[model samples]
Target: MNRALLLHGRQYKPFKGFMEKTKQVWLVVFLFAFSGRVAAQADTMARQSAFRVFLDNDFINLRGHGSDQAYTNGIRLDYFNVLSGRRGLFSWMPRAGENSVNTTGVSAMQVMYSPEDLKKRQPDSSDFPYSGGLTASYSLHSSNPAKKFSLRSEITGGVMGPPALGEEMQRMVHRIMGFIEPKGWDYQLKTDLLINVDFTAEKMLHEFGRGAELVGGANASLGSMNNAASVYAIFRAGHINPYFNGFLAQTNAYRGSKKLFYNIIVSPRAELQIYNALVDGGLFRRWSGRDVSKANRPTLTASELNLGIDYGFALSW
Candidate 1:
């Protein structure tokens, strides 16, 4: 009973502002009624739970001349056991489970931005990406519970629109506080319309003593993220027996393990950026280089390395 309440509480905090928008509410409904989330992970039917919810503290490390930190908090709702064999909303889709992990669907959303973006618009400052939007995807993996090697993969796509609403709210709050941000520049949301397709494939590099497994993987993505290509080395920590990922639950193979459940996964990643459409001063060009009159933002496709970490937690019946 306590767990049920905990799950409900977990799902509400992220979408508290959602009820104000009818479109977003409908989007939420449509996602639940249709194909599902984590479109890639849905290929198999493992860890057959009707639902799962999770939260993440996500970070991005940028390198180069104007190096600085980037961050975002992510919340996701994953539907695993939603599909029944030949008897569900996706009746035409293939029914899977026996041989691999099949996660039917997923629906999610996130807000991405830098703390500086919220400050008064500074024509002289770096233009960092800031926006929030919805997403749906699929996930699929093949593995035997507790086994050493696991093949896991997924594809995710979505948009984080500009911060028109947030900007107004910020201005209003500043007025109330008698605190005004710097003026003379038009501050805009980092990305007006962003579409991203991300992919990850990894294997169990090794296992820990009765507690956790280490996963190593490579990730690549394309689309309008302005990121032409990204390849990374992944190190993940998860339950040794269940092999659980907060976003994606464990397989039936991990079920009933005698090991006690203590939930936490630390995913440290080292990524090499092959191409980046959004670079340096971000959307603001004059903020970088010597030419204050430089009007055009440079589209960078240079190579760079990034160090990042993901903290995750999971709960299920």
Candidate 2:
């Protein structure tokens, strides 16, 4: 009996050692990945294109998913006199053409500009267009807690052209508060909330352009960090353009008036650290594409895929 007990104890010692080493290895790997992501973010912020130009291209083929094969390209340009510090930001989110399967088109570019950099360059508050810009953002995380949690949010907004122009739009919009146009860009006040805890992880809530729309969804991240991905289900409801159709003199006779659609998106996002720069690639499938005029039209099964990439730059005082 004594000899048998000794053999069992000896065998258990190796198992315990193996478990401890395994835990240490995983911890090291997690720290390495986290540090790498932070370093990449910093690098992105440090390196600014002399002209500050950005282009995002999406070559999406949506056949088995829901729609036809489609491709999208977006371009953004910023001209800055790094010497004199004069800068201008311009962008376009135009689509190649109308897709028959999904009838999807890219939204207009969100435009914004500031004479001085809010992050670093502080100008006289009295200066025209001193601060602000257009808004665009994204976030990502996991549903499982045993892994790690990564969440991010980005927003860009500011007045374009001279302060006088912003004043002009304000004046005109108020003056013709009763007149309506077919369609036009509307100011947006979007807020996003994300929560990941317990088994019920990942929730997204968003409000777009005031009462124009309300959206909510849940997501699940699958796979490991090296091969991470997520799937989400989203629901959007509200007027297509409340300001344009109701206040901006736009005709409300078509299906474009008040519409609601249920969209399911199988989003695949990947992160990579290259040369200390963190690059994120996203692909989205927006299903149930249809223009609702009377609310009785059958919802289309077509899908629209969007591909996007964003790079964050780290700045330090």
Candidate 3:
């Protein structure tokens, strides 16, 4: 009995130590897993808090060399927020890839066009027409970092012509800036409803080192406001972030620090324009008892092919 008790005591001591060691190992693992989960939650919170707002204006007169013709004045306000999950309205849209980040935006915009001779009561018939548009849009942007691709879709609704308040807005700006007052708004396009849907997709073509890359994309629009399709290629070089990181992937958040970001971009595009409401007038013409054969009367149908190049520099900190 004494020998048996001695043997049992020796085995029990080692067994107890083994059990204690296993508990310590499990505690360490649990702590590590808990901390990792906390970190992931924090990262998600940071991403959710990153909201953006933009106010943009385009005025031909702002540039010292450009004249107030063709596209003259425009203004847009945008609000964007990162979507937390892809369960609701986001699910209705197409995804870029498996690892896609989604963002939603709302924007209000107004654009104006003018003829070369703004002071003429009856502008030349062949010159660009006096037109304006006011539109509000809702959009969804999806980007995939793993695949280096992005997709954007938007729905816009509003009005064109006098109801857009284009003439009023332009005259107000001219008065404030002491510029020549425009006098040819009476022949502008008649009031019409504007509704449109636009879609754009882009993919990375090649990456040249860490600072330069090339991307290709295509865009199409359909509706009463505008109908067009275009394909473009963009070349960007300089200190920049990957194109699929955050908020169009133009910027990113690093682990330890922040630095200035800048890039020089050149984009060339080819477009097939089917119909332009601002220039071709509305789909259904409304007669104002004016002579239809008059030279000043705008046409209700137009289409053209265009090629253009845009180059600019961007900076952010």
Candidate 4:
């Protein structure tokens, strides 16, 4: 009887510890979300429905489950409801294209498939999704360009559909030897939650005659996902002028001076994961992907750097 009680105690101890740690993780997320809201204006963006549609290509996600650097392209439609006036804060619910990563993350460079392959595609590997997130942003656009600013806070959560971005897992051994296309990308469940806030205020420090505005802004973001907090800095420049679009504009950039215009956007960015949690073992596994079993997994984080260029037109009514 004593031995039986001893064994039960051992099991209960670890389970209790895990639950406590999980609570701490959620607590931190809640605090970050609250602080982000406090740092913004009392009012949100203008509730007016200024909707826009966009097609985007992300030459980023350097740490995605797989390699689709060249094939990332998708269309997104989002609506902006002003919570306050332009001065007030606004909220946003955005779906970044269904299975956006899978759709665009296709390996245009290496992998090839026939049209029939499309029909034969398995749902698990399909680029279709049901996902979206909510965001609150505030924009200050003053005549004194220096006073122009854009502040945004976002909490985004969704699933990656399937592990389509990565290679197969059961073939882990063969993949290690580069034998069978080296799969094992998204071996875990594909849901992820990210909480981020970015503040951007620009100054037209330099401009050429009917040319471009050399602008600078403080573009900072902090969020958490995959049991880690993610940070990124954004750099913007060139001929296209940027007007902080708050949550309304989605991804359309334009020259502020034109009624209908297109602009060239060059943005260089970097991201890093810090203070990681080892709730699950294994480096390639996202939070959902990690095996609760401790035998083969270790806590880890990832970092990334990217240079992306965007060209698109916008209309202001």
Task: Give the clash count for each candidate.
Answer: 19, 21, 0, 22
Best candidate, TM-score: 3
List RMSD in Å for every model shown.
12.8, 28.2, 24.1, 20.1
lDDT of 3 at 27: 10
User: Model 2, poorest ten-residue lDDT window?
Assistant: 1-10
Over the stretch 152-258, how does candidate 4's per-residue lDDT look in tens digits?
33433322322222223213322453332312232323433333343333444454556444444444444442333222223333334434333333233342554
Locate the minimum summed-lDDT window of 10 residues in model 1. Answer: 4-13
Q: Report the Cα lDDT for residue 65, model 4.
A: 24
Give the range of the ten consecutive residues with the poorest summed lDDT in model 4. Answer: 1-10
**Higher-lDDT candidate of 1 and 2:** 1
lDDT (CA) per prediction: 0.38, 0.20, 0.65, 0.28
Residue 137 error, candidate 4, Å: 10
Estimated TM-score per prediction? 0.51, 0.17, 0.73, 0.37
lDDT of 2 at 136: 30
Give the runs in model 4 whose Cα sits over 4 Å from its true position: 1-49, 55-75, 81-146, 158-186, 190-201, 226-263, 270-301, 304-317
Q: Candidate 2 residues 1-317, lDDT tens each?
A: 00000000001112112233221010001122221110011112222212333432211111111110111122344321111121223112111122201011111222221221222233222221211122232111112112212121122322222321322332243245332221211221112211111111223344454433322222222211012222333332232222111111111111332233222122222222111000011112111121222121111111112222121111111
The 10-residue segment with the lowest total lDDT in model 3: 1-10
Please give the ranking of all candidate structures by lDDT, highest first, separated by commas.
Answer: 3, 1, 4, 2
